[model samples]
Target: MGWFYSIDIIEGWLPATIWALVAIAMVVLLVAQRKSLKRAGLQIGIGLLSGALGLLATWLVSNVFVVFGVSLGWPVIFAVAAGFALLGFAISAAVMTHTWRRVVAIVLIPLALLATTMRVNAIYGEYQTVGSLFDYSPYPHISTLNLSLNTISVKDWNEQVKVKSRNTSNIPKSGKLVHVDIPNTASGFQAREALVWLPPAAFAKHPPRLPVMVMLAGQPGSPTRFFTASDTVKILAEFANKHHGLAPIVVSPDQNTEATRNSLCANTTKWGNAETYLTQDVPDWITENLPVSTQADEWTIGGFSQGGTCSTQLAPNHPNIYGNVLAVDGEIAPTDGSVDHMVKEYFNGSKSAYERQVPRNAIVNNAPSHQLMILGAGERDAESVSNIKKIGDTAEKNGWTVFRFTVKNWGHDWHAVNAVFKVALPYLCERMGLGNANVDFPTDSKIRELA
Candidate 1:
């Protein structure tokens, strides 16, 4: 099913613009009540404090429930937060008697409402906007190879990768985005459709084998989340158009099988065998079903948020499969909640097992050498930026070639994902030998400026 909505007109920019206008009106109202400064000031401070307390209470409650494996989805969480805002407004309004103070309370109520709407939009509005614009016309499945999973030998696969990597022409007009069900015959992964973004090269009459990027989405999100919000297909398309359709075959697999089930990308009895589903089943399906390069260097394991954490975890643990890793706003470890919660729920109450599953712990223990790693986050996403920088430094010290980047003026949102991809795709092109080695691209220009 298409997760995209066609209400961009109402839900995307319109509401956000209105909220900004409301904020401006609130400022004007505050200025109008400037004559009664002392009274207005006291009421405004109290109202703001109350609102903050309410939000803090909601966060505290949310964290408490997370330990019990109960996920209060964003909408419900926001509703609870809104309740607190109302309570704050009510309490503050009751104590104020002056006309200007009453007017300030009236303006603040709508201001709080507008802020809530703005927050919701910032978090999720991109999905609706892009989902609405996307062309989800079903494309016929295309597979250039007809081999069984295990039949292809190392010698032939290596030769094929070499041949396909050299071709620069014979590209199609555009690629296709299709829903695929990577059979979870053994792992019993929750039923969810994966998204395959086949580049124009994959659609040519005699399709050249492309490299593969097994991507994962954040928890409480689907594969379509990346497709709709980040414009990943568009990013790949631009890269392909520039380099004669040489782009990675990006497959965003379904990580959070159930709506509330955050498997933490592990092989756990409680959450299903997510690790097997991702590392083994995904690669097996790609190798057997698609005409994609199987050379380790040509392959990438990447994702945003939890998926990014999963990439760091999976790639290091299974270095023979994925040679390159791109993690955008990745967590430092694999976790359902706190370490204690992760241990209790998925690790059979074993702290050691929980520690072993964390990406940093696993990487430190395994110590894979010469791996290409990109650790990216938004400048505004302070925690993630800090985590990735620390992790990247550690990885580099351990003999890995790590590139750390931060997108300016973005937080932990879809725009950050797009920004990272902008730099990452070109870097991949150079690494995979898809484009001219000497010719610098605009991504290089951006990188220089960032540097």
Candidate 2:
């Protein structure tokens, strides 16, 4: 069952084979219905009309009804419309006079839908494997921090401690994923179990100090998506393999307690004290519990989508906490509802208070500091790209070093997250004094796969 669940549904031969079959079925059905030209015309007409309706429905949901709140964007809108088109074509073709043709078209209906689903999934890149699609937990969830961790002193991390060349003969090949609870002592935010990824260097006989990354999953996601959806562990491990297992020890702390909940990553009465949890509680726990750098420059705050928006908001607001920011497909501002509604609900009806929490405002208000803000978004996700660019402009004007890029042919999905994070890993490692920065986006064959 595990192996079955592990089957790749995005790119590999499985999806390819499934798609090939779907195409063949469509072709066969169209050819069989050639004699019934009138019926064929009607099927095509229905498919076209359905596609138009799909676009209208999508527009209504995204704009008027506000089902998803934000625009699903053109790519997602088109994908949904294509699905409707396929379904319409299949159903119309099925209502033929011939019994065999009807049966074939009936079978093709489910196949067509499944293929459409795959197409949409490809666009989002959310569910790479069946296990991740359904979210199968592989590790035990512990609600307590490890007591016997080799702790780091705060004052010792004043200067950058480079990861000097050392024998990695005893180092493990990859990182270990640990699911543990970070006690929300200060913030009182009821967060879910956080995830920790320790590189092979962490398990070494005498582990050198490593940088820490406080990664946050999307609003509608959990820490587990770092592994299941993003394949982040593998990407980090690949980088670690080249640098004697010296990648940052990434900890994905929970921002939103539940999948559907949106904390807005703020210290508010409406949601939870997410800002306090991230900036204080989570950092304090890391300093005391993990063998990580206590230097703020060595720490990174990053996330995807809502989490991305959080990173943009938090990193500059608490610059002493995080010097590096990696935000992928983030919103222009965090919003639980309409601007006025969010102001009322999350900011006690103070529009000025809500304005302060906006990511661009945070960057603008922040004093000139030695910070690195990596603003990223998928090319297809135009809204996010525009949003990040706005934030990037603010960050640059505020005297922060900014590296901004967009992954072509990707959208506001895990695929974009994986690409942005993986490509930036080498540079981030170098910045944290890991030595030898290898820009692996277009040059490295492995990293190129992300683009």
Candidate 3:
């Protein structure tokens, strides 16, 4: 069963074969329903008409009135229209006289639905392997982390960052990812389990204090997605292996109470105080538990999509705590929909209270000195590219060192998330005093200007 569930759903011969089978079934059912040329014409006509209507509806919803908030693009729109046409084909065939024809039509329904889902996923690049679809993770999960005796005290922290050791004899072959429950002591914000990534260096007998990167997953996502969806652990390990096992400790903490819920990453009446959770509870727990650096310059907050917005919000809002920021495809501002009712929401009704929470406004207001922020999105994700540039422009104007990046051959999906992070990992490691990666990220120029 595990092997059966391990099939790759994103790209492979299996998905192609399924789509081919569905197409063959649709044609078979179409031909079997033909009582005569006249009857066959009627059936085909209805299916085509239904498909046209579906396509029109999708276009209107995606473009005209702005349903789903973002455009579904041509691929998704076509897949959705094909779904409607598949239903039309099934319904038309079900009215046939033969029981065999009806049974065939019935079988086509689920197959077509699966095909549509696969098509959309292929376009958006969301779910990769079949195991990811089932929420299967490949990391260790424990009740609690016992690091008190394993770690040195804050007072004993070395002035030099981790990876100072030239010897690699004691370093583990691979890093460790442990899922555990972080005590919500300060904010009392209800959140799911958090994930911690310890570099191979941390496993050594005399591990030096390492830098910290606090990661937040996007909405409709969880902490494990930071591992399963993106390539953080893999890229970090590669960097560590090259630089004598030096990598920043990455911690994934949940801000939202549920998977789909949006807490706006702000304190409010309707949703929990997610801002307080990240700023106070999360940091305090890390300071007490992890054997990592305590300086603000050694700490970074980063995320994707909604999580990215949270990073921008939290880092700028509390520069004294997080001196670095990495916002990948983050929103221009925290919003539920088109209109952001600042005066009537949270403080009055919504979670994102005022302009102060916005990255564009916050960057200038705080005026972080020599802070480095990286803004990135997929090359095809126009919305994110635009939003990040808007925010990055403000950061540049305010004297913040900003780097813009675009993930190639992907858009608004996990592939883009992984690509962006892979590039950023080397740069981030060097920033944390790890051995140089020889990465030149086109500082003082646009992302397109990168060689």
Clashes of each: 0, 0, 4
Tell me how candidate 3 scores on lDDT: 0.76
Candidate 2 local lDDT, 316-394, one digit each (tens):
8999989999888899998887899888888788887788779889888886867988878887777887887788888
User: Where is the poorest 10-residue window by lDDT in model 3?
Assistant: 152-161
lDDT by residue (tens digit), candidate 3, 236-283: 888878766668989999988888888778886657788899999988
Give the Cα-based TM-score of candidate 1 against the true structure: 0.73
Q: After TM-score superposition, what is the CA distance of residue 342 in candidate 1 from its true location, in Å? A: 1.8
lDDT of 2 at 261: 91
Which clashing pairs does model 2 show?
Answer: none
Clashing pairs in 1: none
Extract clashing residue pairs from model 3.
345-349, 345-350, 346-349, 346-350
- Segments of candidate 3 deviating more than 4 angstroms: 1-5, 30-41, 134-138, 142-167, 338-343, 349-353, 449-451
Top candidate (lDDT): 2
Cα lDDT tens digits, model 1, 1-451, are: 4434444533556566756765564565557668777855765676567657766666666555443232333454555566455546434654554466456556656666655655555553344453433434343443432222232323343355457643224445777777778998768877587888887666444455677888877766777776776768888888877665567888888877864577888887677888888888888888877767778888999998888888988887788888999888788777666677778888787788777677777778878577888878766566777778778877777777887778776656666778777877887866875655764443321221122
What alpha-carbon RMSD in Å does predicted model 1 have with respect to the real structure? 7.2
lDDT of 1: 0.68
Ten contiguous residues minimizing lDDT sum, candidate 2: 441-450
